[model samples]
Target: MKKLIINADDFGYSRGVNYGIIDSHQQGVLTSTTFMTNMPGAEHAVELANQNPDLGVGVHLVLTCDRPLLDTHKTIVDANGDFRKLGFYKGAFTIDYEEVYDEWKAQIEKFLSFGLEPTHLDSHHHINSFGDIPEVFLKLAKEYNLPVRNNMDITEDIKTTDSFSYLIETALKDDQSLNELFESNQTVEVMSHPAYLDKKLMDTSSFTYPRIDEVEFLTHPRIIELIDARSDIQLSTFKDI
Candidate 1:
């Protein structure tokens, strides 16, 4: 059987986003989600997770687009205490791995403090996949006995999810083509952002994203029809495997 891990990212972004993610799991195909510990809506996300334990929770570890959980001063962020734009930072690659490791540990500990045992680890803007940063996550994963998202391409032994764009495209594609295309693959993991964007979300993100549309697409009756028509594919959570 083909397994699919349908996960919604950014669980603790805003009220609209948090509620939308919960709605996706409750009324649609979302099986898992990753939380941002330092975001504004984290406590609310924790409450939602408590109400729904079956929705596998993971740490959406932040490395950009926000301040760190722990301090790195100028090493990771500017004097103004904000991270540089993703493109500028990606181009520089001047990061202190040890500082990064310490910050990630703090984030994970915050999750644990909330009594959540994360099923996996992934990063904001996928900074963990950038050069040399995978080592930090791998080390922490081993230390914590958690699975790191296969952003580093270690493969076969690591946990992972497919890109958000690819998953959205496939979901919005003609159903006739998707079923035939999936006939060959035994498993697929779809990463997604199924949310109702709030002004807070707009303020945090650099560009306006189509979150409401994505949620609509994920919960649409056509998606249900496509999934039911393919007996070979089973919707699964990360912990289910």
Candidate 2:
């Protein structure tokens, strides 16, 4: 059987994002999502998750995007104390692995404090896959006994999807069919960012307006019909794996 996990990233990014993810899951084929525990709408996201127990929820580990939960540190934060922007990671930058582990551990702990059992682990901007960070990421995964989104560079004995794809952008840009995307993989994780645009999203992320389009694409009737018709294709969540 071909099992597909359509996971929405940044579930707790904002009220707009939280609503968009829920809409996609309830009305569309989205099976799972990861929460940004440090985001402003985290509590709201938790409430929604509590209301919809079937939607698989996990922690979206962070090192970039928002302020850290721990006290300000030299390596991960800028002079203003917020996490350095994405560009900082792209260039020559220094990150302390110990700090990353501590912050991420706290993020997961915060998520657990809400009484929600997390289904898995992933990172914001794929930061956990960068440099020596996978060491820390895998350490936490083993400690927590949680599955992770596959990062090909990491060779540790960690639980993860067989393959991973950013389906929201690739599907729209290449017009690829679902079967082509899934190929021979029995278990695939397709990443998506589906959200309604709001002032917080607009100010915080440059990739804002396209999320509204993703919500539409994810919930499209044709996509739902295609999955339903394919007996070989089963929609699944991380927890199911």
Q: Count the backbone clashes (under 3 Å) in each candidate.
A: 0, 0
- Which residue pairs overlap in candidate 2's backbone? none
Report how far off residue 113 is in candidate 2 (Å): 0.3
- The alpha-carbon RMSD values of the candidates against the true structure, listed in the order shown, are 2.3, 1.9
lDDT of 1 by residue, 64-91 (tens): 8677777655677778887656785567
Task: Point out the worst 10-residue segment of candidate 2 by lDDT.
Answer: 167-176
lDDT against the true structure, each candidate: 0.76, 0.87
For candidate 2, lDDT tens digit of each residue in 1-241? 8788999999999999999999999999889999999999999999999999999999999888989998857799988889878788886777787888889999999999999999999999998877778889889989999999986464557778878887665642332466676676688889999999999999989899889988998898877886788787788999877
lDDT, residue 225, candidate 2: 80
RMSD of 1: 2.3
On a 0 to 1 TM-score scale, where does candidate 2 land against the true structure?
0.95
**Please, what is the TM-score per model?**
0.89, 0.95
Q: Which stretches of candidate 2 lie over 4 Å from their true place?
A: 169-176
